[model samples]
Target: MTAPVSRRSGGRAARKAIREAPLTDDVRPIRPGMEGGRYKPLSQEQVEQIHEAALKALETIGLADAPDSGVAYLTGAGAAQGDDGRIRFPRSVVEDALAKACKKITLHGRDPKNDLELWGSRVHYGTAGAAVHMVDVNGREYRDSTVQDLHDAARICDQLDNIHFVQRPMVCRDIADNREMDLNTIYACCSGTTKHIGTSFTEPDYVPPALEMLHMIAGGEEAWRARPFVSNSNCFVVPPMKFATEACQVMENCIEGGMPVLLLSAGMAGATTPSTIAGAIVQATAECLAGLVYVNAVKPGHPAIFGTWPFGLDLRSGAMTGGSGEQALLSAGCAQMHKHYGLPGGAVGGITDAKLPDMQAGWEAMCSNVMAGLAGLNMVYESAGMHASLLGFCHESLILGDDLIGHAMRCVRGIEVNDVTLALDQIAEVCMGGPGHYLGTDQTLLRMQSDYVYPSLGNRMSPKEWSENDKPDLIENTIARKERILSERSAARFDPLLDAEIRRKFNIHLPA
Candidate 1:
């Protein structure tokens, strides 16, 4: 179903005349940060049980490999360290931290209008992945993703109405040096889009230099701190109860640098986590809750996203199947738990195991994207462009996924039932006095732009019309759309002088 397209007249003419418009400053019927907790995969009792189980796990099994500073902070905040070096949190500590956790956070964009207020079950979809290979549409093959590719992807996302934020989707395989890669990733994303960007750091030290670049972009350290446009996607924990030592340190630095932290716990079900969906949620919740306590211990009420991102594994082949129904349920269940705690949280969705953006990719992407929004996930990560279980990123697929997410957000918006929406008067007038059909109604025209969302790349033609139009393929259309967007659109969102200064100071590989 498409968003309500404006009609010039009736039937075919209206359909044909529905032009694909540019992204405007006007608010859409379905927009970013819409509340969406309509679907509940887990019951209240089930949520309570999972919460209890997670608390029990933290109290009993505990977590291992806490760095010395982490040990100090956690212990000082009511965590106990055993002789075996496992740091265990008492239930009170966990509860205290949960109470202290920031419930509402504004992930600011350099442009103030793009800021995302993450609170409750407000839904937002965006790009995110760590794909090593880029899906070359012209060549129909995978190639090393470069910094330029990342920048281009960001530029594409800036024009996509459905994509709310641009996270680092693919790694820069061109940059071998880890520090250079980290810094360039930040620069490319910032220079490409004004939307809030999400990126990862190699180590705690890499953050300071990256912050310097961010400071330059924001004009000063104070301005950057006041409206930090980028967040650290820190995977602070290894699955099954252990801290990633370096990642935890990196999280600390990000918290200190006035950057928001995504306390991510990505455990693959049936492998790193339990096979059952509830068990996986329990483990992920426990890990991220522990992360919450760690963050609170460092600084109370710090803005940290409760990222419980657990993927599904095809047990038969031991391969990651991000597109599976189980993965969708897992994400929905995790979102439920996040809501139970009243914390701003994130989950993965719209990932595809398909090698290409075919019918299989469409079904897979739509299924999870719809489910994730309905479940009210605050940040729907990897909601576009990921393919082959996230080994590759496709620009064409990303563009198509925007249309898919547009429909999904429409689902999240659901139906509005009110006095005007009841429309009994209109129905009476149409049936009794008016011409048999409501085709040329004033209400229809008035509500057209406000009530509906139209896809730029989606085809709405009849079979004969489609044949007459030369049977345009969706992929080809998406490819043309991508080319048009990249060629016609501005790749550089930053000022030319600022970009030049950035290039002059840093070893920036992306062309100006």
Candidate 2:
């Protein structure tokens, strides 16, 4: 509230604004040992073992056709590239990247540089694939995408403090210009609304627009310098594989400019990668090593995230389904390999083949997301249909996933150690006093939010009360939440002139 034109006798308007309370040093409390969440994290011992496995895979069997520039660094440093295209790396290369990689980064939310921090105990999430799909606030399915849907989705994502970053479309069908709508929409949505964005420059000339937009949110050079632009770099390294010149060039630019990269290699068993988990891990390890070498070569200290996915393809369909159990195993293995490099691990999740959010969605998403989370993925991609090797996206899954992410978060909240939970005397007092009272206490009032995640999509009311208003299920609640969010959401802003300029620069137009 602002001061009144006239002051009251008590000088009520003169009180300095006080903070709500100090922010908890949550990062420290939730490190290494203690457990608290929907599932258990790998023990330190397990993490060590996985890391070792990744090292062994990298040194003896490096990675394949990993862009020539990347291979030059590795093989030049004791790696071996076989005729088969698999360039096996030495343990030293993995150690080198990890040595140079900034393990912890704060990926700023409002300013790309001020936002996110990795390498701490903080768990982060984001998506990297394209041709997006979106859901409006009212739970309406908006096929392909429009600037309107883009604005609405960005608004909702902007509102959710839970989600750290917004990847461009969940799937944008507006491919009039090689997913250029995706390019502009991603920039427009993230600029003023949030600091972090998940994107890739589609062409060599395509980078300026996206980078400028990102630079806008980052404020200026000092800010961008501090955070450095970080993004998803799925190093294409499977059957019939090689990185695109544009992809490699953009990646080269990112490293040269000191931006961070997530070197990801995805494949499906038998079709693109070996059918065995170990083979897939080796294959993925090589791919990540290849990417790391390129980054490390250009800018030695650039941050790098290591990852992979060897999801099995349904032989008949020859399509990668997000819900495959193999996805869980692949993600788990990827986590191990990333650890091998002593780099942050990343993977994909919130997957399913239901073509919609239903039981299949729940199962596939729960398994992959939960496993990835528990396995301690530094950053994991969330959303669905990405099944055509992450080429597709479904809207309903995105909504249902909001709830799933909530649960995943709650699972990882960890045990609390505040004044109350520390329970130095209160618990003893309650026990001695005979625990009869259920309420009417200061402590209870102070801890409600911490104790519960009041649901937006769970069954909680009496059937009588529910029926009176016409009972609705979780899906309905999800739909309603979407509607409410869209209706009330304040759309974010962008530089209209700058946007117009970018339109001219790209020579692209939105379709009707």
Candidate 3:
């Protein structure tokens, strides 16, 4: 008689035999560019009222501190400079700029497959922060983030299916000089991943050197301009309506250099802006509208995201409360305003006040992310791996966020009520003729992989099995996954010749 087959070996063979086929783009349940707008927190009238208020603010209150060049650009485009030294945009000018703005833009990635189309209410999640600290999960302590940490974060984002782009999420404390820091930030992110990157420059002068390194990576300056893989996340507005002088100059340079710009207006409620939610939105909208005029004045119809990232504050303590419900509503409201103008927009979401990636972090992250997606935000920033109200970044938390964003995208996809999905016949067959369940049915098997999302680290084991399997810890398991990925991932997709040229030309900090 044959020796009895071992249960463990038999189980492995059975699992291998039943493994599902590979998935294709057509069958992917969730993906970048999925339309949102299913959740509308503001009525149409309310949106229009806010728009009117914003226009009034721009035409009346105006913006202060526009550089001489900016004043010239704005005045040439029908904006008036008052005797008080403020630049006032005529309502007509603002409207014209909005009409001429690039309604749909493609954020090109160094890898063509990672390109993101920004139009409609399509939602794309990605990393965005300037977190200075790195959370040491094992030690449960925070330390200054380094260039290595930035590169590692990019690499992690490159592999995560749900994170569509890799923006500079942390600053490199190792690089001392400001100019050096800017250039190295570019190198580290590009070398780490080919996804579309968002980086900021300290001054206008730093941009050119950074572009040269990018040119070498892109094969030439002309190629880099054609499919410029990086965008300038310019915080053009200081707050409650004033131009950040240096940032405005940087914006001008980026526009002239053929790079996309995110016209960022990050006003904080109850502090820099009005305490009321609607009032905060009005201020942010007015500020971003001025940004639109600035961009079009510089170069009409140029690529820019209508970025209105107004943050919330704790009224009691006057501290920023990024994870609060008020912050979520603020972001969602801004998304609605973006939809109103039919311009590509970006907003902040998925931030957590919790210092660690525990249950508190989970609830806070999911709340903002779900609302951002449902509100039809085109680009949702800070959607992963941010902690302690954006002061810290964690590698393991980034890995876990991939799973969180997957579920959020599923919500954006909503339900399809097609005839096939209704499956009246399948239901009847299961209830009347087939076994009391439909677990092994053809339709069930066909829809399983396409219609469902499985978390990489989430637990689903029954109590008995969990105890038998030693009750794994989510954080520990996620750390293991992070290690496996970093170990198995190939070096950045850079040509050896170009990489060497980049090093010779610039202060490249990342190791070859």
Candidate 4:
């Protein structure tokens, strides 16, 4: 009996060792494109009501200030243009556009492995925004963001398992010209990560040059078209039923250039959009639906993301409250609208009104991120590292957000209930005096890796253990991890010759 017990203990130790070992991408407990939509903020009837309101808004209110090309595109697609120059979509026209719009899209990465399948409740989280400042948490100061900052952010994002894509998160304040800034933004983000990138063009002409750079990186126009790794985060609307004319033109160029477009409608609640949450959803939905019509009209079946990003406002101070519970509901509600239309969608989440990565930032970030994932947002943009109501980006917080998003994704993965997961046989064996506990059981050993996610920076030790270890500061530890990652050579950098060619072609501001 003693010999049997010793052998059993040895088996348990071996299993523990295996479980503690690093896992490959295939076996990691949480990954990109995990299914969500488990949390529905709106009922079926409510969803339909919002849809009807949006359609009604489009037909009645319509949108103003479309560029001439956009006007041609919409008018040609059965929409009517008013004397005031607003494009009004008849119900049938909007429905037709919806029917023709691509339901699923693959935002490819330079490396095929990072491609994101956007359909149904499949969720992917990543960085987004054009923050002007970089948060120096240790110094408690904010400074202008530079091209190097953008590149470093992408490099950090490439290593993080939970951040699924790299959207241009900060403006390159180092570059004065808008064209050069836009060009450098593309070059910096693409050079640091092979993950699907998202960027914006300052002008229609900028699109051609940016696409030329992308073509050079992709080896040719055909290759770039085959796997256009970057997407355009085009804010096509000026909110309250108006179009951003220049942005619309930029969107047209992007469509012609073979890039996916995120039709962003960012109306602030109580400001640009209606104050009521439901009303805000209606306005944003209406705007994005109009964008859908525009995209389909320009070229039927163009891949477009229904980006309905309505922000929350503090009625008292009249400031944007990105981390508020109202913001979470707004994002989740928009996600449900996306599902109702059966379209690929993106929404904002994990943004912190807090200025730093403190206790407030943690709760603020977690609340919306978990809710967004649970609500099945296809692309949860700004899901990490945003601060000061989206004015600042932080490297330390970005690293910490990787751990935060990992936990949120596990929640999104939810509980798996099957015969095997029920574990009736294992339970019976344990109850029948077979070790009296299941920790050392074969089922326990087999499921450990698949059933759990472990955080890299999060401390889970007991108080005594923590004290023994000198009570490691979370921020300090995160800084150390960030340093270590930056210290290593990035695998995502372009080849030497390719890098030289790109430098020769453009006034690349980033240091080699």
Candidate 5:
């Protein structure tokens, strides 16, 4: 009896060691581009109704304020410009544009291993925002975000497995000139991470210089075009059926430069868009369809994401409520519309109205993130680190979000109900004249890493164990991890000579 007990205990110890070991990408329980169309906020009929409404909107109300070039592009592609200068798309023209659009796109990373295949219900989560302030969670204070903050965010993202891509999250307040800011944003992000990056240009004139920098980074113009790792997050349209003229010009420049475009239309509900949920979705869809038409008109089959980011609002105070349930529904519904068109799409999620990475922030971020993934959003942007309704970004929150998104992705992975998963053989073996429990079973040990996900910073110890181990605070642990990452030599940095040349050519604000 003593010998049997000792053998069982040793087996348990061996199993624990195996369970704690690091897992390879192939065997990891969750990964980028996991399939997640399991939840549908809009029914089939509702989706069709919304689509029809959007088409009607484009045909009648149309969009105003197209720039001279945009007017030419749209009119040249069968759109009618009335005396009011609004471009109206006929059903046939919109359909043609849809038919010509690229059905699938690959967002290449500088390292080929991080490439994201965007199509269908496959989901990938990443960061995106334009917050001007950074949240110092420890001090409970907010301050102007700098270029170094942006670079550090990217470096932290580089080490996180769950953050699939890094979009420019904050303004570089340290840089005074808009052109220099745009260039440095690109340089700071690219130099910190090999993942696919998304950024915006302040002016159409800024595009050429930015592309020149990208060419240098990619070795040449031809090489840059072949594997363009950067995408322009272009807010091509103003809300309520209108084109932002300069933004449109920026979109055209990015297209001419062979970069993928995220045709973002971010309309605040109860203000820019309609108060009702369905109404907001309809407006966002119409605007994005118009954008698709514009993209195809400029260059047929151009890669563009259907970005319908309709945010939520607090009707009582008329303030943005990015963490609300209505916001989740908006993102999920837009995702359904993207699926309806068979196009790669993106929407905002994991935003928090709370000022810090506190309890409110946790619930808010997790709620939308899970819903967004469940709805199968191809690119879930702003999926972490946003706070104070997009006014602030927190580095600790971004680090913690890696663990949060991992759990969300696991939920997105859902259940696998195969014969092996049924475990009838294992069950029978356990009950038939064997130990009362299956704690040290071969099946349990073998499936430990593949079938489960474990959080890195989230504590799961009991009170007794917690006290015995010296209780750890979540934020404290996160800060320690953040320090560890920044202290290490980053693998994501550019080659030394190449970095020196880039610094010489551009006024990069972040130190080498």
Candidate 6:
């Protein structure tokens, strides 16, 4: 369904409008367009082999801490579960589950009728599980993030149509007081917009609270699922390297609710995981597959998303190098690995480990994003401004990020052909025997807007025109653009009164 056109220029009366941008590059299908690069695309059969290898890792080595249902199924199906807490299954079991599984699913938004597109040809962008800082209206940082930071980020995200799903960013300030914190964030997303609301909960007791809050905001589980806020429910699957009791509960809730669950595992290469990128890829794959197989095992045919975010260690200080080349390779390889399983693949692009928004951040960020789109990842997260990755977030970075994603959309989309693009008849009609008369044709006028990319930053205006304009740098132009949008548009709200009621129940201070 066509979303409502909400792209008004922000508060700045004279600024140009920021249109609802396209997710994938509208350019593709052209033969040899941005294809056949140093990085090779995996063949369908090659992807299958990784799937088999992943299944073998599960069957032979077996992942530890599989749920009781998983253990029971593996044991019942001629598998072995040693007291060591690892359960090994034969390739047949995994193959059987995948065969019986319907990999295609649409996690419903508040309107079950409203579904996020998945498994399409191009990559769709999303955010990974967690991050700390957030950007405010004036491009300022709110560190250690609070409840207000969370809701506004969600609200800002809700307005940006290019973002496919809203992963629960660190909105709640206090992990210690999750009971009070969860309510504000969950209800804010439920009431603020119709985009998929990624649910947030941690630990055992937090599970009941999260569910209670979701029910409170959404009416109840049946209603919540019916007009489900979360379109695709992907979670952080604790690495074999670490444990969080709450992550497990989160997994359980995802399955029980039948939301699309992606088991996300991130471990550093050479540290928590083996030093090599290949080694980390396999280990991380094993980690997520181990959990996903549980999802399939518990409720046969349940929709599951496949994911991996394996970090690599910096040889220097033994730190988790988030935006390393190893990460890029791992994310691309992760997409291929998941493709092997015939499941939806999820990974990140547009990442930066830079401490600030600068050239290094933009360049490093563009590489991951472009590759992920070229590799055609199913769900690519961390699309916006993520500086130092999980360590920091910058405001201006988000403005720069959408353009990086724009380029990725460009790279993956390739090219499209039509009567206009071919220009065959037009060329013959306009310039058959004369000097180039094609420029004078109505055809050229009709096609200019279609072909040119009106970039947010890379404006190539004439020097005279540029001198005349009040806006100078790209940041000035972007700030003006944002003000125009927030001023002219407000997202679909639940109700001022119901919002007040939710705030009264949750004791949150919402935007007036």
Question: Among these predicted structures, which one has the highest TM-score?
Answer: 5
Write the residue-wise lDDT of candidate 1 on 1-512 in tens digits. 87776554455465446433343546366789988999999989999999999999999999999899999999999999999999999999999999999999999987887899999889999999889999987787999999989988998988887899998999999999999999999988987888999999987899999999999999999999899999999999999899999999998998999999999999999999999999999999999999999999999999999999999999999999999999999999999999999999999999999988889999999999999999999999999999999999999998989999989999998999999989898999999978877765888766766678877778887899799999999888888888887886464467779878888888998776
Q: Which of 3 and 5 is the better model by lDDT?
A: 5
Q: In candidate 5, what are the lDDT values of residues 1-512, reduced to their tens digit?
A: 55456875587678667767878988999999999999998999999999999999999999999999999999999999998888999999999999999999999999999999999999999999999999998889999999999999999999999999999999999899999999999998998899999999999999999999999999999999999999999999989899999999999999999999999999999999999999999999999999999999999998999999999999999999999999999999999999999999999999999999999999999999999999999999999999999999999999999999999999999999999999998889989987867786788877888998888899987899799888988999999999999998667788899999998998888777
What tens digits encode model 3's per-residue C-alpha lDDT throughout 179-230?
Answer: 9999989888887888899999999999888877878888888998899999
Q: Answer with 3 or 6, whichever has the higher lDDT.
A: 3
* lDDT score at residue 487, model 1, on the 0-100 scale: 87
Candidate 3 lDDT (Cα, 0 to 1): 0.91
What's model 4's overall lDDT? 0.94
Location of the lowest summed lDDT over 10 successive residues in candidate 2: 27-36
Give the lDDT of residue 299 in candidate 3: 94
Better of 2 and 6 by TM-score: 6
Give the per-residue lDDT digits (tens) of candidate 6, residues 1-512: 98675443232222233222342444322211232122445566755655666667776677666555455755765567767877776767666766766576565566543355555333676554466765443544456766655555565665554565667655465434666665566665665556666655544455555565566557677776665555334444555533234565566666676455666776777777778766677777776766555666667777666768777678788875556776777788777776555566677766677776667887777777777766767777776767776666544566566666666666676666877688788777766775567653576644444454445566666787688885478766666655564454346466577656666665665565
For each candidate in turn, the TM-score is 0.96, 0.77, 0.96, 0.97, 0.98, 0.82
Candidate 2 per-residue C-alpha lDDT over 1-512 given as tens digits, one digit per residue, 9 for 90 to 100: 98666543333323212112322435222222122223333455655665566567666555444567656665675567788876766777666665776665555455432266555334665544554554332454435555555555566666554455666654435445744754655554554265466655556455555566556545665676676544645454543245444566667766655566666577677777777666666566656665666566667766766657556667777777667877777776566555544566677776666555557667787787767666666676754323334544544445556556666655666466778688657666677774755343556545544454444465666788689777877766766776787777354554577556555655443421
Task: Answer with 4 or 5, whichever has the higher TM-score.
Answer: 5
Which rank order by lDDT, best down to worst? 5, 4, 1, 3, 6, 2
Using lDDT as the measure, name the better of candidate 1 and candidate 4: 4
